[model samples]
Target: MGQKVRWGIIGLGNIARNFVKDLALVNEAQIYAVASRDMGKAQAFSKEYQVPNAFGSYKELFDCKEVDVVYIATPHTLHSELTIMAMDNGKHVLCEKPMGVNRVEVQKMIAAAQRNKVFLMEALWSRFNPAIKKVKETVDSGEIGSLAYLHADFAFYALDRDFEGRVLNPKLAGGSLLDIGIYPIFLSYLLLGNPDQILSTSNFHANGAEIQTSIIFKYPKAQAILYSGFTSRSEMKAEISGEKGTIYIPGRWHEAQGFTIDRNNENEEIKLPTTGRGYYYEINEVHACLSQGKLESDLWSHQNSLDLITIMDTVRKQNGIVFPFEE
Candidate 1:
């Protein structure tokens, strides 16, 4: 709808800062405005990123006609409410992962996007990574030959931090399952669609938030083991094993640097270098999709987002992790 994709950033946090830096790599992308609850912070982010406008309230950013898209970098709990507000005001949205706290909120966000005729997508940036792209290609090519089992994990130690920190606060929808856990879950779903059955367990912190979680997904022909935690760091390697061979993505595989293939008694390494810390690809995707007037990305479609959240909801239900917002 505009010559350049003008971006308005909501919630100027650490991730927001990283995204702004990544925006520099996209020729057709620009950060036109920023919003935060604190006027000072908003102004600081605006000046730091050379954004032309800053708002103390999200409402102001949404109402600004110059903002063609709003990238939501708020905590997990606030995504549903804030995304709906942005879409209702005719702004396209690229929300951070765990698109909503639950499936219901995701449903509402999708409905709002459709009703307002604005594009909306979850910022599952890992899906757009080049290493992951190549891995998916290998899987689809049947190089793996009927995926049988997969193991993936994401974890980090942050239990000693203040209870109110976004990683451990229940009010903010804080938990290993929602934050780091989504990576493993996405890997499983991407390699194998929605599982036929899900079995999960979690270790809760003193504050009742999940500190660790392990999930098992059973498919008709395959099974996946996925885990995430906040009390310790995991290697964060992802592997897909099938009848023919096993594919291994190096550590921190969610934002992988490269991958190795083991097939037919032979092994080979494939390397992919990321520019702008790997956030540039997703930004470019948003620019392309919005310019084409698409409501959602086919790669990360609305139904796909729904499917991931629904699996998360089921895992939460099984683990007895309830968010206060759930009715």
Candidate 2:
């Protein structure tokens, strides 16, 4: 067996809870420590996960010599700050996506990695998803013919939640766009590359948090229709259509279980099961890269993270969906 990669995680939120469960499934990963602003919360998480150490603040985890990498699961606004801190401490990073609140922050994070000569990656787990990977391969192989159109959406009913919560809180950079919109945007960008033009519309709450956003990315040979909102539940299915046939990824396509291809008016289904909430794949990628003494995964390189943020930045600029931190 290869040497285990010691991981320290910060932010003990719902997403972090799911991530820890999946981390347990990766044989080469070790829960060296976890940190949170609240010492009590940090201790509780460490006890629950059976981690070796717990720290009251993020810097403690970064300074810990036993921890080789840190997973930043904090709010979008805090991503850049925490990731750079980790890298500056000579620890690698797997910061959760959007990677930053905007493109500038992402660039800073990437620069930190290069300056420190440490690994860094946005935790965009979907990029390593088996079903999505196969679909990308199929499209690249010309099996789907020349792509003409793509449709993908991600939405959930969250209007009833507390206004002060993350979903509606401008201070936290909370909104549907960065929260769920990245999925559809990722699918479109993966299949069609950057669009020639992008048009977008957004609705905002009284507090200036963007509640909903619909975007259209126009390519020379193709177009993508994407939507993300907190107004109501949307069909999370994703469709990529071409001249010869169409490929359909069923609901919750970001963590899709499988996909289908329709050719000659016949539908053929394919299943690609993932291990443990689909985070194991990315965790494995990180381990593989670390073992190979690499700074980033080729599958989801630094450029990919920057491009994804750049696209969202354009969409935000078009619709006036500015986060407070960016100001």
Candidate 3:
């Protein structure tokens, strides 16, 4: 831990803001540079975060010798392009989730990492969440018998957001399925692996942007019912139930601070507060992989990303949820 890993952040969006805040909590990491399309935004962000370097162009940041890794926080459509560029420049990458809009884009991103021999990972922070990890471990230990059912939903009334913003805009690969639906989908995949079959449908805005999605991942013995939307708000609770009992991730379960277990009329709640907004867990995961000279994370491997996107691709195809870019 003699030399801290220097991180360069692109896309000065809200997610990147929250991620930089969490990076401050980890001593092994540093925000060395920040870049935005607008020079004013880049300078302002670098000043606010006390970062040493600010680039108006992303490639200048990529070309920076001081940056050891780059965090791609751009729109979903830009993930593959920017990630491949950054990796080709000899920098590790931690791209935000929904790694790509579909499997083809994701496969190319994976190939970029392999070709460059650089560390790469999708920033699926929840996979490293202590409470969620503990719950998964508990479920695996047969504490809840066998997982037979799981219900998870993520939604926030985003209908009022900008019609052309990422959340509601079809051009940015926007929609609940790739934006928030991936949470519930990931929860199921984490606990149940891939599903035998996926049944799904969507409700779209007048402009053709998908606003709501209801999905059922069918397995041989277990089934996961998941949903995501911008039309209304959901409790965002997740219930992982088994033959013996259930585990409850209450209220905004994706970044859950704790979870509960109910079995035989008994209840137990375990709380594991995050350092910041919980992005640091995945940041540290990146650091760990870089330290070990590994190309991918074991917890959230390249295969895991492929499987996740492949599943979403199926749902999109099944329901005709095509982004403007894909067409």
* C-alpha lDDT score of every prediction, in listed order: 0.92, 0.92, 0.93
Worst 10 residues of 2 by lDDT: 318-327
- RMSD each, Å: 1.0, 1.2, 0.9
lDDT of 1 by residue, 1-327 (tens): 668889999988889889999998888988899999999999988888888999999999999998999999999989999999999999999999999999999999999999999999999999999999889989989988999999999998988888898889998899999998999999999989999999999999888889999999999999999999988998999889999999999889998888999988799989898888888989988988977778899889999999999999999999899966663
Off by over 4 Å in 1: none
**On residues 84-168, what C-alpha lDDT tens digit does candidate 3 reach at each position?**
9999999999999988889999999999999999998999999999888998999999999999999999999998889888888
Clashes of each: 0, 0, 0
Displacement of residue 182 (Cα, Å) in model 2 is: 0.8
Worst 10 residues of 3 by lDDT: 318-327
- Which residue pairs collide, candidate 2? none
Q: Whose lDDT is greatest here?
A: 3
> What pairs collide in candidate 1?
none
Q: Tell me how many residue pairs clash in candidate 1.
A: 0
Cα RMSD for predicted model 3:
0.9
Residue 140 Cα positional deviation in candidate 2, in Å, after optimal superposition: 0.4
Residue 317 deviation, candidate 3, in Å?
A: 0.4
